[model samples]
Target: ASYPYKTTQQSCKARSSKVGAIKGYGNTLRGDEEGMRQALDTYGPLAAAIHTTTDLQFYGGSSSGHGAGIIDIPSCSKQVDHAIAIVGYGTENGKDYW
Candidate 1:
């Protein structure tokens, strides 16, 4: 898609151009945050699945200079549902987060 000339509501159209390719893929241990972090640090981004709910959708974290800490939503499920990529992780304000 052309960023400069693209339309917002353009009808979906078929294209014959190939953008990129996937070299390889694999899985990490279920419910393993450390393993996921290691995989991301060593092999680049990683895709993960988690549960999503109304509370999660509205979470914006604290803004009192504490910075956001590790987000552990115990209510989130282990089953595959929503998919998100783990590009990177680090600590903020002495809090380990992802």
Candidate 2:
């Protein structure tokens, strides 16, 4: 959650998992266009969910490996189609709401 994690590759991996929980998988979160919309669009639901769950929250694309900080979708990489939500730090942030 501090300096060390930021520089390491774990930063990106950690951030990725954070969002994944919030997105709600299987029948719990219910995957749909809305989930994608909440991610792609501004911080309407997706962002709020992250903030409410974690005090130190951020949203961004993994393509740049700058998760929460990356608001603008990087044009250079199209491989970051996967959306995720960072519930907490160190440990995975589980889903609280649907």
TM-score of each: 0.61, 0.20
Clash count for candidate 1 is 0
Tell me the tens digit of each residue's lDDT in model 1 across 47-92. Answer: 7766776655545455632334456666756566678877888886
Q: How far is candidate 2 from the true structure (C-alpha RMSD, Å)?
A: 13.6
lDDT values, one for every candidate: 0.68, 0.37
- C-alpha lDDT of residue 22 in model 1: 92
RMSD of each: 6.4, 13.6
State the local distance difference test value for candidate 2: 0.37
Q: Residue 61 in model 1: shift from native, Å?
A: 6.8
Best by lDDT: 1
How far does residue 60 in candidate 2 sit from its true spot (Å)? 11
